[model samples]
Target chain A: MCTCNKKNEYIPYPAKIESVKKESFDTKTFRVRFTDKNLAESFQYKQGQFMEVSILGVGEAPISITSSPSRKGFLEFNIRATGKVTDAIHALKKGDALYLRGPYGNSFPLEELKGKNLYFIAGGIGLAPLRSLINMVMDNRDDFKHVKILYGAKTPADMCFADELEVWKKIPDTEVWLTVDKPCDAWGCSIGVVTELWKETDVHPENAVAIVCGPAIMIKFVTLALKKSGFAGKDIIMTLERYMKCGIGKCGHCNIAGKFVCTDGPVFSYEQVKAFPEKEHVI
Target chain B: MSKMIEKKKIKGLLKEAVKQWHTYVPQKHIGGDVLIAPLPEEAKELEAALDNISLADDDLVISPKDIFFPQLETMFKFKKGEIAETVESSPKLLFGIKSCDLKGILFADEFFKRDFEDAYYLSRANERLIVVIGCINPPRPGACFCTSAKTGPFAEKGFDLQLVDNGESYFVETGSEKGEEFVAKYSGFFQDESGDAEKAVNSIKAKAEKAVELKIEFQKALDLMANDDFIPEEKYKRIGERCVYCGACVYTCPTCTCFNVFDNAKGDEGTRVRIWDACIFEGYTREASGHNPRNQKWLMACRRYEHKLKYDKAKTNMSGCVGCGRCLASCPVDIGMSKFVQEITEDKKIM
Candidate 1:
């Protein structure tokens, strides 16, 4: 019986954007800290969880927590200027106060992936959520073995976290592979989809887990590719996106069959996702 | 101890009740439709309104769920970027509620208070008292299936007080401490029930249960939905093509709690509002980037029934439908949960 007064769950906490890093032409990573010092210190969240970011007079959108909890500083949100709320968020400068509620939804299974081969597959802005776990794993590199990152974008300019990707490439026992659908003159990566990175690197699914996030089609294909490369249904993990109002389960917008993506998941194994009654609609 | 009240003295008791609680009762509108609405505060208006008070078993056009979860609600008001949550409520008395509708309220009670408490609903619901009037006959004999759904014609629990119609007198059975306190507070209006009152109430309950004529294979349908690989895509397509997307079913449904939130701003000042949203709507599940997984008409149609029958039951152990027949009664297309259940269970196509 938790007696915490949850009456104000809908009301968001005011947070200030400490800094903004341009991820791409349309996406920006905001470094936010809560205005309340106590809240800033107490706030904790796992990788793959999301927050309901609100801009006054605009609206709220679900953005994944791109920063790792292990960092213990400002929280980061990789937001693309696509929706009305994101557009308003994009207009904000440093020191601008926005509102946030929740470090909601289930996070990536961290304890299970320990000491196992880790494969991070992402596409375009989908890399935002995976970056949280990627950085966490990088900080404690001894816990995992053979880290591989397979990322793809539409073009060279669409690639996000380029500096961080470079930093990750230099990590020992880690493989960072990048690809672009349409390469620029300065581009020096493979020119293909993210799944094509398997050709350039070893992708044995033995004692390994492939974490994937992307557009629905990309996830579908990636899951197929992972399975084709001898990955079991439970070995492939993916994060999903949906139109969510309440990051809690009440606002039934994010349900895929019986499971609410907001509460039951935003992260589910391919095994669990494959069993959804409306798997066709979800995947 | 149970008490009894003369059928004729209800109006007088209600008038006296208005001073203490914001009482709601079923009243007939000018258009001849009966609805559960708030009693007027003014004495003159109250008298005239009570004169039209309907105690009939006829279904209300709108369920009493609106009293707690309004179709549209203001979550918070913001001026100059500061939020002021509008959480205010007063003590209320919901009188003459049917068993099915009362069950709907009980179900909603669990939903709004589950993992996260919805302040707007709880503030009102927590302070309210429920007095359910058991129906002697099915409100909509052709549509009501409470017995099949195991929700009515009388609620087994969750009401503060229950009124069993006993010819000239009504037997008042207290269900909770609130009901006991209410009886104590208004002791003059109530009298001790005769020994025959219990036997009479039992007989009435049996009769009411038998009165429900519409009995779809509700349990079988639930089993089929839960156990079988029941993907009736073609059936959904037919129903979807016929559906006008009018949202009458979800609007009138007592258990449908899905809502959409948006900010209404006129400049620096605005309010964040949440309104009832139907799962069948195309834009309900559509992403901001123009991607929609449940985009097709059939898919939206599937989501609604599956949510009510399969998902909600799996999650809450309570089926979303209370068998009030409001969805079928309010629908223009004649597609309702009962009809869908019949269609699936009987292996027949619905026109």
Candidate 2:
């Protein structure tokens, strides 16, 4: 309705929070739909792509789309209250209006993973982006050979999607493993870093692709573990996190080497990531 | 045959130009620095004006980049919950810009239009015409190195009109259709050369190219930096140690287009604006979770050079450095791209 794309990519469309669910102390999951019904219906995004979420007079931040396209009524964002824009977004109640501009960046290679074993590895809020792909894989369960989700958090309370985890565990032939760095009295799951779960699960590189999303340090160790587990660089996929302004790549803040993360990727195979000169800075 | 205009008629041309479009020319500021600025709205006699209007003789401390990609520009305005787009543009003429600065504009044009078009920059760029004045002598002799960068003493393309000074008059050549139209419209100011001006123009161009005394191994430096593992951490640390983080290089650079967006608000009404940003700052790459990839000063220094010499060349097939030498002129510390290239290829220390 606003014709934001035609007029200016910087001009964002108004959207309202349909609902808000507290995922953690600093994180909240918001279900948002465009204020314009037609625009909402037309908006489409893939698993790992992100949107530039704006809070009118505050600012904007890049938040990954957490909702799967298969369940496409509304978009969801799991935002952490870490900076000016995100803090302002966290303060907003249900039905509060905000602005959105993207669905920018490349998404996961879902086509290549068809009929192949899928391994999803995430830590803390890292699970947010991978959740989009995980749910899509679940919806079309028959299309995939196997599904394994290894998620971890700093603490039991920091773990997100607690109820959904139970639902996913009940899905036939799908495996969901969650761990916590600091477990509570009621906790019954394994405790340690995510790599510790490598011993418990049978993660084979043969005919399987491993998708990982987490903090840089966690990603580094996960990449090493995956490599040691006989996974090739091309078989290990990871999503990156960077401070970015314009999600359309005009803003050079997200640039590394000759690649712009906003355009070239938020998702890249380990083989590609290895080729970046400043890969150490990334993961 | 090319047109020619006497050096004495420059004031008259500018005076006439202001009447037609938003005209920018190098004017001496009260601080004694020359900057490219728009003519005052109120009409004034050019000869009688106290403000010294520099015409191809003085160094303009600031390039003409700010005319299109300003230091700060408002993207949109919002009141309460309602949002609106606020893009505005008007026809403009940039007169007496140096050749290096024109090349910078051309590079910026590609950068802003690549992949996704930036409406703000493209809108302003579409309404603009460039008039470059070729340098007969290096304006900043100590810092200017347009010869090695291969972008100047006179631009080969992208200018609307290029003027080469031949002492008594200027040999005018059109690089675009807009330039031809401009010459036809302002035929009174520009006239057919009275004599064989090609010889004079060629001689002046040679003299101007020779006046740029500073040269660096720009190509070899690019080749050295081509290897991703050529991490000159020690060199970067040395340069970073001397850097004041003043952001003078980026601000003065014609090709440094990185910007940070924020909102300026009062009560419920507010405007979102993007301001020029430097990558050397720690906050430029710092994430929301307090993690920074380029947190170190040396890393920041590396990024700045790698962007200009390495990444830009690989991506756009153009070096980001125009060899305008504003970086050295503006830097409190003498860390210019020419010096950096020298350090990379010749093993000379910048500091």
Candidate 3:
């Protein structure tokens, strides 16, 4: 993990893409190996922290770390070809060189969530960042209380890490509820929006910390669902996405008033989000 | 401490200073006015030009913010998968800057140096020297309320040197140690003053204060708005409606420091650049998924006023508006700070 100044000036460590696995038609996960073995060995990132991946001639984009900190020697990022930089990133193949700048931002308060029940909600590709925390909790399964993951995608084909989700189903004291926007003959997951599946779960909200990430629309509805189910404002945490040009706070693009989402948060508590003067419900 | 310079030898003094430093002065152009282009080679042309050309207030176009916090600066460069290491900056001297404009630079300093220091700004700022030329003449039309804002025709800080034009010549006042060094280097051009320097400076201050006709009780307005109960949503909307959302006020205003960064890429080497961004833009608050927190123009307008007048005051013990009145000049619909404040204080509904 590299620490940067306010200007985000730091030494860039070279990294080579070890492999690129297509998760979906639009999304692929890149596993990268750092050039410096010691730097790679000491590398640590919490859930929700992102790295500024630069493709020399192409620009840099903030991509959330998908691989768990418990996992070693390599890092993973699930990239969707949504914009210019990501499109350039998607064009790269195995052995392509790049530069990484972060492990920037405060992460999930895992220590605070240790004894609490964990309710993980993810929509579409949002599972990438949440997977880090989920894997960590699974590694130390007995340290945490009841863990349940409710994931939803636009369709059955859009779901990411299919084989990993199947493995998660066999973990003791863990439950995985998969949902799709529409039902398909080939799909075994529940049909309808993720919020609909959230309504069916009898979550012990008083003793649980709910971690949610997804498209803004999905997160909005999921937040309302969690609130209706008795989750306190502070108990709900969500990772936000904005059009950030600089992963550092100097670029004003990612700021919501005084809070720079790039630095202050990509993850914020419901209490913090509510304090934003411009916040409005989409649904 | 302030000192006086001879009224007769102002041009000679400036010319001598130019030999050593990168000096800038207002120059007239067909388009309007621009700050000091490099001095011409013909020394007589430079000297003769100063007499006919006084400071061009209309030509005062570029904000000093660009001098320190550049619009498109390369933070670093990378090539062949390795970070390229090269840093170069030149010392600068900005002359004939109006006092209100000087205050704007001071505000930027406070913001960049607060809590988390911006080294990029500091690095650039450290390389420059500011020489403020007091606004002997008030700004045209809507540029009168800078005195009320306590940043006016004269400034106390953020200048290495201050030159007060006293008809025959200029009365120079050293503002920083850098100013003193420059003075000491050119000790031949300066002469010991006979206490008349103090009287000249006082008279200039008196003239500037008298020239300011508009006034506002900034503290009272700030107090009224600080109370959430006093400021209503409907009144805020009413005030905001008058704004054209052209972003001219933000672009011209000296203290608005919002910026956006993007990359200009070519082949394998790309430069990430930070450009000026305004809150008034529709996309400023837009999310990636097409949702915007500040979706309404009226709401954004309200935010601009509240952030400068209320929030910045609370955070830094200073109002964000330096009262340069550029907004008043630039706004197509004349709903700038002066008019906005008058409406807020006079209208019972808003008060």
Candidate 4:
């Protein structure tokens, strides 16, 4: 057994804000270049894993890595200006410095989804992590079978990565659908919740993997829709969120039942979700 | 082997130990009472408080958890606008921990160091050496159930050294390599004589066992608590009603290791502090978006019990309660684990 009481200090890698782009009205995507270019080159992360973005005085927030590992040079984080830390992060500009701790937590098992028809569903800011995986699968298009992407936002202006979604829509054998809760006159997307488009697609449940992320209510309906449409528990995967203070699992904030989202999972199979006691209406 | 030290020599031993190491012992505090304070030179004139006083009936005056995991500690400090960091570490000795409190410390060690290790907690925990003072007398009124939990009067594991008071001197049983080193350093005060020491220790053990009023089948109580058997809603409410929400029970609990991390920053320089937090607090699990998994007092009460009886047991193979009785003492409304356990075990009526 390993000896107890080992002191492992968190090494802060300096990441410079290379550039920042406003993705939505309240959200921005940052492209950071690490001080040590080798560290940036060596940094490898699976989709759904998150990093601790620290603004020295403000504190750290676990943000999902938005850019795919396949597309690299620097890392990317799509953050919504919500709380104190995120608000501080929003004030940062190019040439400012930030500290990153990890590419922590279990990520999506892309290898498990290999050669299977994939259904990707996301709502609002939830598309951040899913976008990374979608890009990776698109790069390795021949390894995966049929692909379907259904996305939703509160409004047309609330949508993130619209240009990227447009590009994915042009890919062969990939079906991309977008929806808005409320539609404007110029909006060309479907006018309804993402769940409303469930009837428009035909998916093979036995040979498909469905990945969904969104607000708790939206994810609930999406999961139910997927289940009713014949996806088994194992074929469905999700990324769960909680108020995690310590990304190392000691602070006890991210616990659902006995599982620590930081250590045990942020990514879980629907079968595991079904077994959790707090399985009611979880996003 | 245990040996006798004349009561008069207790002061001298403490003084000598202090000269060599930073020793902490119980001392008279304000309010004309005693608490676990640093043993000063002049304070040694009084009799060793470890022997004269019995465990408090209401609450332990001080929790032993502080000896290892202090309430407020700086894990590391970072300078403003600079990425430089420095961690603080210190070494000290704890002198008068009781058997039950020692067990609680052991429980904390297991909890914090297992599965996903906490570097900050572990780093601070490594700096101390534990010296356990065995309980030779019965605990005051509120202290009974520790013997039932198999973690009282005397401890078998966790402590570096176990000291049993044998009227004239302490019978020191070295439990770890650190204890052996401690004995070696103080070899002048000890003599090798095993037979008499064994007899004295046995007599003391027998007296302590007879003095204990609390008795229970701990495994059975644990099993019942974990079982899906009906737990009356009224019983839970009665316990909740008695809770003043003071949070003293959780604060004093050695095994209650829940914490909250907050950043204390001024400009670009600050430190992240992990402070002790209890599940009973209103906002313990409150989300940034104002959602809480446990919003009611009854649910909080259930969560505490489940943590002690169900969660810790399943994870660590040990009951969370070391039966330290601090909760019983510190609680303003007289609600404690002992009373709760007694109610659950004896009152078949449930309410």
Cα lDDT of model 1 by residue, B1-351, tens digit: 569998899998899899999999999999899988989989999999999998879779888888999889988999986889887588899999999899899889898888778888888776888999999998877789899999999989999999999888889988999999998888888899858778889999999888988988898878788874675678888888888898889988989889999999999899999999999898988998899988788788877888888877887888888999988888898988889889999998765
Model 2, B1-351: lDDT tens digits are: 679888877777777777788888888878888888878757654444425777765788777888889999999889977877777677899988999999999999899888888888887777778999988888888799899889889888989999988777888989999999998987888888877777877788888888899988888888888777785678888888888888999999989999999999998899999999998887888888899877788788778898898889888888888999999988887888888888888876656
Q: Which of 2 and 3 is ahead in TM-score? A: 2
lDDT (10s digit) by residue, model 2, range A1-283: 2211345789899999999999987899999999999999988889899999998888999999999999876999999999899999999999899899888999999999998998999999999999999899899999898888999899998988888888888998889998899999999998999999998898899999999999989999999999999999999999998887899898888887778889999999999998876633777
Per-residue alpha-carbon lDDT of candidate 3 for residues A1-283, written as tens digits (9 for 90 to 100) = 1121454343346898999999976899999988889988888888789988877656677889998887888899998887677888899999998778778777888899999999999999999999988988988888998989999998888989888898998998889999998767988768899987856677669689999998877888898888988999999999888766556665566766556777888889988887766323322
Q: What is the TM-score of each candidate against the true structure?
A: 0.96, 0.97, 0.89, 0.90
Q: Rate the local accuracy (lDDT) of all candidates.
A: 0.89, 0.87, 0.75, 0.75
Candidate 4: list runs displaced more than 4 Å: A1-11, A278-283, B32-59, B138-140, B191-195, B225-244, B343-351
Could you tell me how far off, in angstroms, the CA of residue B243 lies in candidate 2 after the best superposition? Answer: 1.7
Candidate number with greatest DockQ: 2
Model 3: CAPRI class: acceptable
- Minimum summed lDDT over a 10-residue window in model 3 chain A is located at A1-10
Candidate 3 regions off by >4 Å?
A1-13, A36-38, A278-283, B36-59, B76-88, B114-119, B225-245, B287-291, B348-351
Q: Hey, what RMSD does candidate 3 come out at?
A: 3.6
Per-candidate clashes, comma-separated: 0, 0, 3, 4
Model 1: how far is B291 from its true place, Å?
Answer: 1.1
Per-residue lDDT for B53-89 in model 4, tens only?
Answer: 3323223466767766667655555685565444444
Provide the TM-score of the second chain in candidate 2: 0.95
